[model samples]
Target: MEMAWFVIVTVMLAMYVVLDGFDFGVGMVYPFVAHTEADRQTVRASIGPVWNANEVWLIAAGGVLFFAYPKAYAAGFSGFYLALILVLWLLIFRGLALELREQVDHVLWRQAWDTAFTTSSVLLAVVFGTALGNLIRGVPLNRDGYFFVPLWTDFQPGAAPGILDWFTMLLGLSCTVILAFHGANYLVMKTEGLLYQRTVSAARILGWMSAGYTVLTVIAVPLVQPSLALNFSRNPVVYLAPLIGVIALGYSLYFRIRGRDTSAFLASSVFIFLMLVSVMFGMYPNILVSTTDQALSLTVYNAATDSYGLTAGISWFVGGFLLILTYQIYLYSQFWGKTRADDAH
Candidate 1:
């Protein structure tokens, strides 16, 4: 049951990344791709109908974490309190920017919101990537299974490490580039004429950059945490996750070059999904690792709630998942195809 919940949580988070990730990518590429007010509107319209709905997956994943793995959830929230607060603020600003950008006709008003949107989006991507890096690199957990990290401590992933280490920063940058690449593909699929051309050009450059950084991140992962590969070594089939991710990334670029916008976007989605799957595969059993002591790490067994709770929650979870899935399908179908600046919400 605990393991099931772990898989459930992983899938939910991965869904959040693949869904809302393009929204973030849109924000990241907005300034570069949007030159005129019409261009900005088109970009906003492309994501306007679905961005908020996409974030529901993140909220649902957090809720499940709190319910299914209360111990790890509590520890992680408290330990990363500052970082979480920052993320919350960024989310708020990004939301406000999206909602308020067209409230007034003033150029300055729209520009202010535009800046906020792009800045918040880029920062959120970096923070999220850094959080993953911290997880992979381990935290300074005590015997009590809780730890606090400052923003930076000599920028190193030592026994007593900070959240913004060199390794985490690298992943953060990589995430930014990858999301930009992802967003470009999405825009390519949703726009026409000059907008599509610009996005295609951006996607081409960002694609190669994302590929390069992915390679660096993959190499750095094993160096930072050798234990992450133990499961892969034992069960070689697990390697397929990353293998598929790389193939998807290659296909995204190939489809982009062939001017197949939808195919490229779908390929980028697959790449993001499979890459996250690889991370989950690498971090199995242990939900949170401890830099202080491996014994203090929170595994699924140690961190899960009572068996009764897990069993009861599954039924509710299934029903809720179905409703959400249906809503998502309907939402996308309604919004399918090219968007125009006049369509901005």
Candidate 2:
């Protein structure tokens, strides 16, 4: 049951990344792809109907984590309290920038909101990537299964590492580039005219950058945390996840170059999905690693609630998950196809 919940939570978070990731990507590339007000509106319109709905996966994942793995959730939230607060503020700012940008017709107002949107999006991507890095690098979990990390400390991932180490920063930058590429593909698929042309050019450049960063990050991962290699050595099948993810990224770039926008977007989605799956595979059972002591790591068994609670939660989760899944499918179907600048308002 704990293992089941682990997979469930992983899937939910993966869904969030694959869906809302492009929204972040769009925001990251908004300024570059959009030249005039109409271009900006077109870019916004591509994601407008579904961005908020997409975030529901994050909220649902959090709720599931709280109930299914209370210990891990508590430790993660409490330990990363300051970082979480910053993420919350960035989310709020991103949403407000999206919703309020059109409230007034003033050019300065729109530009200000645009800047806010892009800045918040980029930071959120970096923060999320850094969080993933911390998870992989392990934290300073004590015997009590809780530990705190400052924003920075010696810029290293040693025994008492900070959140923003050199390794984490590298991953953060990689995430930004990857998401920018993803967003560019999405724009190419969803818009036409000069916006499409600009996105195509952007995607081409970002694709190469994403690939380079991905390779750099992959190389650094084993160096930072040798256990990842040990885990792969134990379960060789897990290697397929990242292997296929690389292939997917290659296909994304190929399709983009070939002018197949939809295929390119889908390929990028697969790449993101598979890359996350690879991480989960590498860290199976262990929800949170302990730098202080391996025994203190939060595994599925140690961090989960009692059997009764987990069993009860599954019933509710199934129903809610289905409803959300249906809503997302219907929502996307309704908003499917090309968007125009005129559709922004």
Candidate 3:
């Protein structure tokens, strides 16, 4: 039951990344891809209908985590309190920027909100990426199962690690680039005219950047923290995660070069999905590792609720999941196809 709930929670988190990730990518690269008001509107239009919906997955993931693993949720939330607050602020501002930007007529007003939107988006991406890095690298969980992390300690990995560090920052940067590429690919599929060509160019450039950064990060992970390599080394088949990622990346690039929008976007999504799943695999049996001691590791078994709670939660979750899934399908179907001026309003 614990394993089942863990898998369900992990899947929910992955769904959040795959769904909100592209929209976050769009915001991160919006300023770069959009030169004029019209360009900005089109970029906004492309994600407008589904951006809010994409965000719900994150909330759902968090809620499920709280329900399924209350202890783990308490530890993680309290330990990363400062970081979580920053993410909250960024999300709020990003949403406000989207809604308030067009509410005013003044050019300065629009520019201010646009700048706010892009800034919040980039920061959100970096912060979220760094959070993932910390998870992979492990946290300084004390015997009490909770510990606070500063923004930086020694600016290095494996030390009394902080919220930001060289290795973690690299992950953040890689995440930024990867999402930018994803967003650009999405734009290619949903846009037309000169903007389409610009997005294609952006996608192509960002794709190569993402590939390079991904390779570098993968190489550095083991060097920084050897524990992440334990599972893969013990079982060679685990290598398929990275292998599939590389193949997906190649397909993304190939399709992009061939001017295949939908395929390229799908490939990009697959690449991200594989990479995240690899992380999940690497850190298996251990949801949150204690940098201070291996004995303190939070695994699916240790961090979960009692079987009775889990059983009840799982049944309720299944019903809610199906309803949400049905709504999502209907929503996407209603908004399917290229976004244009009509979606901007």
Candidate 4:
């Protein structure tokens, strides 16, 4: 039962990443993709209908963590307090920007909100990515089950590293570039004219950045987590994720050259999915690993709720999934097709 809930939580988080990650990517590249007022509107319209709904999965995942795995929820949330607050602020500002941008008629008012939206989205991606890096790279979890991370330590991957270490920072930057590429691809698919061309250029730039940085990060991972080397060495098929990612990168280049926006955007999504899965696979079982102490590693089995709780959670999760699935299908179906000038929320 615990294992089942573990799988459910992982699947939920993965679903959220694949779904909301693209929309967040769109917002991250908003300023670059849409230079003019009309262009901004088109970019906004492209993701307007889906953005809020995209967030529901995150909420559901969090709810599951809080209820099913309360220990992890408390430890992770408290340990990463600063990051959680920053993420919340970003989400709040992004939400306001989405709602208020259209409500105001003044150019300055709309532009201010648009800037906030884009900036928040960009920062959110970086923060989220760094959080993942911190998890994979492991934190300084003590016997008390709580840890703190300052901005930085020595730029190495060894014991008791800081939050903004070179590795984490690079992870954040990699996330930002990848999402920016993802967003640009989305814009290329959803909007046309000057905005499309601009987004295409932006996608090309971000694509290269993401590819290069992701490669560097992948190479650095085994160094960061010596235990993960076995997953690659013992099970060669695990390498397929990165292989698919490279293929996706190639598709991004090809689609950009051929002006195939939808294909490019879809390929970018695949890239994010493969990368995320690779990371999760690398850190299997261990939800939190302490770099300073091998004995302090927190595996999913150790962090899970009791047997009765897991059984109850699974039942509830099934009902919730059906409800969420129904609404999501309706939402996407309603918003399908290329966004138009006349489309308004």
Cα lDDT tens digits for candidate 1, 1-345: 998999899899989988999999999999998999899999999999999999999999999999999999999999999899999999999999999988899989999999999999999999999999998999999988899998899998889999998999998999899988998999888999898889999999999999999999999998898888887898899999899999999999999999999999999999998888888779888899998888899999999999999999999999999999999999999999999989955
Model 4: per-residue Cα lDDT over 1-345, one tens digit each: 766666677777877877888888888887766677777778788888888888999999899887777777878998899889999999999899988888879989987998898888888889988998898889888887778877777867667688877778888888888877887777777876777778778888888888798789888778788777776677789889878977987887788778777788778878787777777766767778888787877777777778887886677789989999899999988877777766787
lDDT of 2 by residue, 1-345 (tens): 998999999999999988999999999999998999889989999999999999999999999999999999999999989889999999999999999999999989999999999999999999999999999999999999999998899998988999989999998998889988998899898988888898899999999999999999999998988888789999998899999999999999999999999999999999999999888878877899898888999999999899999898889999999999999999999989999888853
TM-score of each: 0.99, 0.98, 0.97, 0.94
Residue-wise C-alpha lDDT for candidate 3, range 1-345, written one tens digit per residue:
887887788788888888888988888778887887788888898888888988888998899999888888999999988899999999999999989988889999998999998898788889889999999988898888887888899988764798888889999999899988988888888888888888899999999999899889989888876877988898789899878988999999999999989999999999898888888878887888888888998888888888899988877899989988898899888877788865754
Cand. 4 TM to true fold: 0.94
Q: What RMSD, rounded to one decimal, does every model reach?
A: 0.8, 1.0, 1.2, 1.8
> Which residue runs does candidate 1 get wrong by more than 4 Å?
none
lDDT rank order: 1, 2, 3, 4
**CA error at residue 18 for candidate 2, angstroms:** 0.9
Error of 2 at 54 (Å): 0.6
User: Model 3: which residue pairs collide?
Assistant: none
Whole-structure CA lDDT of model 3: 0.87
> Each model's number of backbone clashes?
0, 0, 0, 0
TM-score, structure 3 vs. true = 0.97
What is the alpha-carbon RMSD of candidate 2 to the true structure? 1.0
Q: What's the ranking of the predictions by TM-score, best on top?
A: 1, 2, 3, 4
